[model samples]
Target: MHRTLLLLVVGVSLAFGVDWFLGEFIEEYVVRIINLCGIAIILAVSLNVINGLCGQFSLGHAGFMAIGAYVSAYFTTTLRVLNTETGETVVRAPLFDGAWGFVPALLIGGMAAAAAGLVVGVPTLRLKGDYLAIATLGFGEIVIIMLTNFESVGAARGLPGLPNYASSFWILTFAWICVVSSVFLQRSTFGRALVAIRENELAAEVMGIRVARLKVMAFIYGAFFAGLAGGLLGHLLRTISPSTFGFMKSIEVVVMLVLGGLGSLTGAIVGAIVLTVLPEALRDVEQQAKLPGIRMVVYALVLILLMIFRPQGIFGQRELSLKLLRRLLPGGRK
Candidate 1:
């Protein structure tokens, strides 16, 4: 316990130090990229719980993200007050200026997304493989379409003028929390059961594991964090539209998981960082070469090369830790 507390302290200190240093020294564009990386990290890690750890193919991550973003934005942008004497209601601007209000708004968004996950997971988890993927894809489309038609959350126009409340420090803190929670869960009994189900569902069932229940739990868990990421993204961008969390957004998150390594937490983080930076890094090259879609072409080439060379992904279910780092270092632990 003491060691754990000490590690936590050190981790927080390092996080804060990095956050401050980057804000102080880095250019605005570079800092924005870093903040986006943090958000991507949260999304990738959260999706890993379902697609990587649970061996489920879900494509509706963006739908949940949309739910979170809209719900959180609503709380932060729209405020309602009731008069005690006149029994009249007044609507005011959103109030998420402080951490106390911001935290609850984010949590409510996450909870709402988790509830949606529960509703979706209970009925659809029975499907497997491509069928499951199609189902989830449909769900994502349905969400976007609904939001597009719904006028309450700013139909096709999108909600704007939101308060920019998501700082690099807050984003990193939440991302770290997601990472630690995912890592610990992967080391727990529930995680083992998930792995077993991934390997062989029938055998897992024969072993007395509640397959359906576990699947639902995994979905809920992943959706909760995805929602959290969405909330962070909404506040960071200070504007959100239904189109922002579309099929392509879900594909982006999946690419991070695949590029990293399924079932590997460290791989997800690394993949998120690399992929998030890749386009920005290529911007100069693209402009200089006068090439449209050059960035994507290069990105595709890299993915193709990776597939040819390391099909199991960069990590292949392995994690990066102090012990592993030591073993890889020259003249270090073997």
Candidate 2:
């Protein structure tokens, strides 16, 4: 416990210190990229819980993210004013501003996403393999269509003017929290049960594991963090559109998980960072060479090469740790 607390303190200090001191020195675009990396880390890790650990194929992650983004933005921007004389609630400016409203709004957003996960998971999780994948894909498309038609959230016009409260420090803090929680969960008995089901559902059930309940739990847990990531992203950009959380967005997260090595937390983090930065790096190169769409061509080539050379992904279900680091270091034990 003491060690954990110490690590937490150190992590918090480092995050804040970087945000306060190093942020000023960095270019705004670089800072934005870093923040996006953090959000991607959260999304990838959370999806790892369901897809990696539980062996579930879900493509509706973006839908949950959309729910969180729109809900949180609504809470932060819309205010209800009560009038005693008319006994009516009037719409006014947002009730919460800055940091004061950001935290609660995020929580509400997470809860809302979790609820949506429950609603979807209860019935859909019973399906296995490609059927599950198709179901989730349908769900994601449905969500995007619903949002596009929902005028309250500005519909296709999108929601704008969200408070810019998602600082680098906050993004890092929440991402770290997600990392710790996911690691802890993976180490617990519940995590073991999920793994068992992932390996063989019938055998797991015979061994007394409640596959349905556990799967639902995994869905809810994963959805919650995805929502949190969405809220952070919405606030960071200060604007959001339904189109932003479309099928391609879900594919992006899946690519990170696959590229990182499914079921490996460290891989998820590394993959998120690498993939998030790769496009930007390529974009720079493209501009210099005056080549349009070159970044995507290179990105596709990299994925193909990776699949051919390292089919199991960069880490292949293994995690990086102090011991592994030491083994890789010079003059250290092999």
Candidate 3:
């Protein structure tokens, strides 16, 4: 409960802060970008569970996102059910109106993704390291390909008729949920077991940790959040395409984890926010000038520098809890 309260307070406060300081910019465009950042945080932190904590290298997150996006899109798209009265459609968006429609769709999307994760993880979790990565990468590619072939989902065309409902409020709420859940999991005995497995699977097996189960659970949980993020993003954008959830998207989330520092929740959130917003900040250049892929080039430089100097990452496996600061500051604690 304390953790939940903290999450609520912090997330709400941050939302208000952004609203205040960024009121102008946000009114124009930053609002949507901030929402995207929140979703990115969800993806990064969730991926951190599978990659940073469990030491798994699965890369099929985009596939899971595509699955969830299509499922959720089906629920709230105008293209679904229509009213017979005057031939006007009874449109129900996934919360573009700040109503109750968005929440349930997002949860359902997360569940569907989680179910998919279980299916995939059950078979693939047995693999480890680079093999796991390759398998997941293939999974993502397969999902994209499958999306292209599905006629009901618009096939090669983009999925549409979605209501734009994503907002900073919803975005921050999801971010807080991801952060708090991650922190809770990390502090639990199960978290300890996961860490043990990550450190040494052979030793953890001897120590009675169900390595496969833990690994599968991590993958499922990671995919669940990934889907939730995708649903939110799709609704916000009011459209979906297989291309949106692709290998590069998965790589972007992983890069967020790496740049923020693996094994650190704070770092993951920071990395996601920075990366999510940075590209948008450069959008002006793209519109009025020629800045093709400049974001990637600058990002590559920063990554190279970070690898050379602080390969351990920004937090270096250390959490950003206030307790650490309080301890270091002598009288900083309440």
The per-model lDDT (C-alpha) reads 0.88, 0.91, 0.83
lDDT of 2 by residue, 105-166 (tens): 99899999999999889999679989998898899899999999886677898888888899
| Candidate 3 whole-model C-alpha lDDT, 0 to 1 | 0.83
TM-score of each: 0.91, 0.93, 0.85
lDDT string, candidate 1, 1-334, tens digits: 6855676677677678888999899998998999999999999999998999889999999999999988888888864445667878767777565656778889899999999899889999779999999899899899999999976667887888667778887788888788877877898999999999999999999999999999999999999998989999999898789999999999889888889998899999999999999999898999999997899989888888988898878888998789999999999967
For model 2, the superposed segments whose C-alpha errors exceed 4 Å read 1-8, 78-91
CA error at residue 308 for candidate 2, angstroms:
2.5
Candidate 1, which segments miss by more than 4 Å at Cα? 1-12, 78-91, 332-334
Candidate 3, run of 10 with poorest lDDT:
90-99
Residues 21-78, candidate 3: write the lDDT tens digits. 6655547565667778888999999999988898888788888888878787777675
Model 2: how far residue 332 lies from native, Å: 3.3
How many backbone collisions does model 3 have? 1
For all predictions, the C-alpha RMSD in Å is 3.8, 3.3, 4.5
Alpha carbon lDDT at 205, candidate 1: 97
